[model samples]
Target: MKSREWTDVGTKLFLATLDGLADAELDAPSLLPGWSRRHVVAHVHHNAEALRRLVSWAETGVENRMYANPEQRAAEIEASAVLPAATLRALVTHSADRLAADFDALPAEVWSHKVITAQGRTVLAVEIPWMRAREVAVHAVDLDAGAGFADLPNDLTAALVADAVAKQNTHGNLPGLAAWLTGRTAEAPSLGRWL
Candidate 1:
């Protein structure tokens, strides 16, 4: 599937999970250590807004950073975590809708424009959807709202595993894992819970 299609699937999956949560469930611990479901929702909402900044930068040729700084980003997430469940739900819904609008409005040529990610890596505007897709898919699991890696689409799971292996390779780790991932070896090596 295309990046936008994957992103749409991720968004639907996330919203579906979000809809099933009770008010009290928002305070329940998530898969991410020390984070509640509320925190996961807040982070996902903020991530959408941040990615919108990148899309805007691509459209306008202006430099728009995703966040003022890492500290500011963390602070915003913490502040958002205190919001009520209804407010958090609205935030997630509205932010995702706004980002979809921004993406759809971009000119074709603007997709080639370069933008810097929060991690400081430069990427083209076209990659933003895939980035958002990954965030939503992974964080939906993190929310622990009955979603799991097994619930994700097969293609997305494969893509994520490939991406993880590639990243580990770049960091000079996870050698031989790629071979196992690609079926070059019948026996996969033990790498416990790296994700």
Candidate 2:
């Protein structure tokens, strides 16, 4: 599969979900606690921008971190979350387009260049698209616009499930997860919020 195919399918799904929301519905709370649909939309746009910066770092041979810091990311989302629905939609769509174009223009040799994610993991530049795929696919559901994980492409869904589970393991409380997966516990493990 092309590195960005996951991104392509994810973006298509996310845009469709966002399209189903009405202007007034943007103010409604999303499946994500405390975030309205507008906040989800805004975060989607900023995520694209952040990933694009990584692509730029790869393309230009300059170091560009995804965000200055965690607070900058949170601040950007909170500020953009209050914009008019139409404006937020247009901005997100444009950002996605811009990120795709940037990805297409990245040099083949640069695909192997290292970049740091907002999460602070050093990954190959090629992983940038998958990073975006994760955001859009999950946030589409968080929008609470009648979309769900089952609506995503099967392969993407599998990849997301694996990624999310691996993340939980990395966070270092695995006994609960192991017990639940093995059916030794009736209750599923409690996890921190999804990114």
Candidate 3:
């Protein structure tokens, strides 16, 4: 699927997954090591706003960064993760809607404008949608609300696996990576959490 399609599908899937959780479940530990379901939802909300900043920079030639710093990003997530369930849901929904509109409003020519990702990779503005698509789709599963990888769109799953492979491949240990990937190794490498 195209990036736009990925974005739409991911957003719908995420929102649907969120709709399944009761208020009590909001405090449950998420699939992400240290995050609660609330943290996952809040991170998704902040991500939409961050990606929107990249879009804005592309649109106007002004530089609007995703975050001032990594520490600030963490602080924001930690702070917002404690909101009431209903309020958190509404915030995530509104941020996502706002981002989608901004994405739609960007001119075709501006899509080729360069923007630096938080990871410091410079990519075309066109890549923003795919960035968001990955976040929502992956985090939907992280919510642990009966949304599993198998439930994701096939294209996104394929892309995600490929992406994981590419990132993990940077270890420069192809044989080790292959061994772990194929389940040949008794103990998989202690690869850190990515994304």
Provide TM-scores for the models: 0.90, 0.96, 0.94
- List residue ranges in candidate 3 displaced over 4 A: none
The lDDT of each candidate is 0.88, 0.89, 0.89
Best by TM-score: 2
User: For model 3, how big is the CA root-mean-square deviation?
Assistant: 1.5
- Ordered list by TM-score, greatest first: 2, 3, 1
Checking candidate 1 for backbone clashes, the offending pairs are none
Give per-residue CA lDDT, model 3, range 1-195, as digits (tens): 288788888899899999998989999999998899999999999999999999999999898889999997899899889988889999999999999999888899999999998988899999999999999989988988888889877988999888877887786656777898799988777667756
Model 2: per-residue Cα lDDT over 100-194, one tens digit each: 99988877899999999888899999899999999998998898888899988888888887887788888875888889989999998878886
Candidate 3 lDDT? 0.89
lDDT of 1 by residue, 15-116 (tens): 999899998999999998788899899999999999999999999989999998999789889999999889999999999999999988888899999999
lDDT of 2: 0.89
How big is the positional error of residue 13 in model 3, measured in Å on the Cα after superposition? 1.2
Please identify which of the two predictions, 1 or 2, would achieve the higher TM-score against the true structure. 2
Model 2 quality (TM-score)? 0.96
RMSD of each: 2.8, 1.2, 1.5
